[model samples]
Target: MLTRQEITILQELAKQYAEIASLPIQKEKRNMWLKLNTIQMERPMVLIDQIPWHEMDVDGFLKTKVSDPHWRGIEWEMRTAIYRWHHMPADLVVNPYICLPRIAENVGWNLPFHAESEVGQYGGQAQTHIFVNQLQEMEDIEKIQPRKIIVHKEREAEMLLEAKEVFGGIIDYRWGGFSSHLGFWDFISLWMGVTNCYIELMDRPEFMHAIMERMTQIHLEEIRQMNELQLYDINTNICHCSQTFLPDLPKEGDIAVSGNAWAFGLAQLFTSVSPAITDEFEVAYMKRIFPYYGAIYYGCCDRLDDRLDIIAKLPKIRKISCSPWSIPEPFAEKMPDYCAMSVKPNPAFLAGESMDEDSIRKEIRRAIAAAKNYNRSVEFILKDITTVRNDPQRLWRWQEIAMEEVQR
Candidate 1:
């Protein structure tokens, strides 16, 4: 139940959101994104997501006044959207709708682990952790099982009804689903420690294949159930922290399936693995599921410069992440022109004691030059931002610089 003050605050934010959504720039940006995604260049786009909100305290701009935990989340989202537009709008499309996700309970894949991390100022962000490996031997592979997704349709309807009652006329509300981040090896590293997994990959090659095979089947079943239930949210504006306003998704008034959306896959843990090794383990399994989506966004923090050829083999490969660790020139030269290069600039530049404005500008320019030299479509995605030394203005300034450079 929302209090009167909470309702008032949300209502005001919704009105502001509606106003922003109604802007002419929103449609223009949407068209630009569609062009970029389809390999028809319209100029590069820039987006800043995966921000460290805990470190941002700009005159209490991110603080929430709402009391309830659930409503507080909604309030925080509304505030963040409005705040983002004011600071680093950067090709973002402010939608006129709020999404209510279906209530789901996932069972199976009962992998156990014990992990420890230091609690500090930026505890909410990523930190160094010590994990206990749960999978010890090849025989332990039997423990993994296909997950069962149970959606509570009645409860989902009730939540949607409540949201409609709150902001029905002020803003539209729709049912949204989770975007796929299907990385089997990434999960395996958590279950079986990174060192152990790598050793097994070299020594017990058969065991590694068995594990990959099982993980692939588990994910396929999970996605199939989600598709059958029509729980996949393909109507989203963002997919894996990049613009998803392409012309080929979320079929109108039809049940949403994996085929109607963009699916994200990566092997961040396999960063040190050779191209052939990655092909056998990561790419082979991921390819099984890649065909299920309308398009695929592959790679993450991993440096994929060597495996561009291997990654190119996947079906519907639309975009590939070019992490900060990757050399822009080589990747740009080799990447398929059909795929958009999702360049992830280093967030460390913002985390320094003082902002390195010159380096930041140079880095963005380097990416731009590389993409232009190869005639590849590109988008600057500033993400995995762990911190800004508690200075929100650092990120704001970076966004300003990114937008200026991309436009030029």
Candidate 2:
């Protein structure tokens, strides 16, 4: 049973959430996303994610009142969602339901790696870490193990029951599988330092290939197990922070496969790697997994301007990320018509002591002009926002600028 304070807080938030979700604009935004995802021409969509919430305490709007840990988490979600909608609702769709995952523990994968970091003064989204290389030699690769998913059905049932008790009458509650993003090279870099990993690609090519092969097998097995356990969440509303409300996905009451959902792939560490080496190590392994998904969203922060041709060869490729590091003109000229360009403006502009509205506007306008020239569907995604200099107004103003540019 919940405390009276918890009940009061959650119920009030649920009612407000339900009211906002019931608005006609929610459906309109979803339909717009569907059109954009399906390669149909629609106005560009703008999204802001990876916010530095520790700094967004405007008049104590983000301060938590609940005492229970679980309730505190739920409270934060509700507060942030409502805050974003009110302040910068750029193509954000507030669904009418709250989803709790089927509680599961990841077992196996015995390989361990460690890192050391310096955190920000406020201790939230600002941090830098240097990974210690754990996989130091070829022999160490033998220690790699397959991962398993161990679902706690009883706990999931209990949580679902408790959520229903709190939110049943106010809004819908869904028990869903965990949504995941898949990228192998990033993990490899954590195990082997980035410089060492790059050296291995050149000096120890066969060793790198063997490691990739093993990682591929491990991931494929994990995906198969999740499918067997019915733990794949195909109805997820977002893919890598961009909307995923496409029309081709399986509808309600339909049996879903891994292919019925979107798969995300990236090799951010391969930013400076040559296309041939990338294809040999990254694309070769990723392609083996891409066939399992109905659609693919690929790349992050990696400058893919020269590598678009390499990326286009992957199966079911629907969207490609164009980071601030990438030259927008080359990407815009060469991107496939069917694939939407998920443009990420530089978050550094927001991290300054003050907002640089001019730089932000020029960067966004450049992307817009390039996309329009090629008749490409564009989605402006502002992510990796590690700091706002303790000023939430900067983010709010950034959103205003983004929406203004996209709308124009």
Candidate 3:
């Protein structure tokens, strides 16, 4: 029953290396995308998911404690993202990813939808209080009452079942359910503030360990339920939560980047920590998490270039995210043959600073070609594309040019 499009998204949802990427976008252009009848369904927007917003007031947080608009908001965001996928092909294939802005707003995070900004930095997101910070807390963390974790995960499962029933075999739910944007470091930013979390990492390593341990415990249980229920999605913010469907999958060779699907999926991020610290502090923890998934993908916000040395350290990584900040030269040279290289452009492009039309076109072409040259499947994800949402022509032109360049 899932629309043909939903089915395509679902298929990727089931894959370990299901690619997650984005690109510049526009609202008027989005409206046009919804209107288009092209059903390649193979385009990015086919994935399923939901959004996770932390830092809500008691009323807002408890609202979901019962049943709240945040649940309903998931449906709203999914519809919009799915509609967009139908209109034009996206650079990075994205599943549904969304911010819990409305729920946050309703529950009193007081998030505002600004006229100039398609997405906002403040008031719209949540504050994540859970973490792997306490090593001793891991046991207690594992026992985290579903009552607490369900603050959001429960609603996600409900939506996933509903969507699955509505869409049927057309969509994939295994690895395509609810994921996180407020992952590891991002969540630390929510609770302690990025700078503060950073400070604690240095001044209070013990505190940091406790947070990660507990967070990891909570994450383990969260994944266990979703994995059993076939609902835990691993994309940022969330695809099922954020949009109506799963993101498009990784290109051919990208799979080799993510260590392995661990039990189900892998959570990778770019912490501002130095390479030495990464080796000392992060790599071991990261390695522990990899063996549990079916496929693995690596690199988050961090330059894939700097982290490449440790790539092999990831036992079964199937995909690697290539950032604008990351250099693909090494990937092209020594990348494991099985890994998928997901190349990213600057989200700042949406701001239209250095990313003028000619420049973006050139940049995309170069990126695409570079990926192809390495025999790596490439995805162009403009994570924050709302910058040009109000301007349809610009959005249309960008899509048209991107399609023209990449299709070749």
Q: lDDT tens string, model 1, 1-408?
A: 677777788888889878888889998999999899988878999999999988776778788988866567677878888899998899898876876655787787888666754454466576556667777777788788779988877766666766876787888877777688787777788887788888888988998899888888888888888888877777666788998877757657756788887888889987898999988888788778899888888888999998899989888888999999999999999998799999999999998789999999999999999999999999999998998988888999999999899888
Error of 1 at 304 (Å): 0.8
Q: Which model, 1 or 2, shows the larger lDDT?
A: 1
Which residue ranges in model 1 land beyond 4 Å of their true spot?
Answer: 65-70, 116-124
Q: Write the per-residue lDDT of candidate 2 for residues 383-406, one digit (tens) a residue.
A: 988888888888899999999988
Q: What tens digits encode model 3's per-residue C-alpha lDDT throughout 134-202?
A: 222334334323312223555555656555554454433322333332245544444344455566668
Candidate 1's TM-score reads 0.96
TM-score of each: 0.96, 0.95, 0.56
Comparing 2 with 3 on TM-score, the higher-scoring candidate is: 2
CA error at residue 69 for candidate 2, angstroms: 4.9
Stretches of candidate 3 exceeding 4 Å from the true structure: 1-82, 91-176, 180-182, 228-230, 233-271, 353-355
Clash number for candidate 3: 94
- Largest lDDT belongs to which candidate? 1
State the lDDT at 359 in candidate 1. Answer: 94
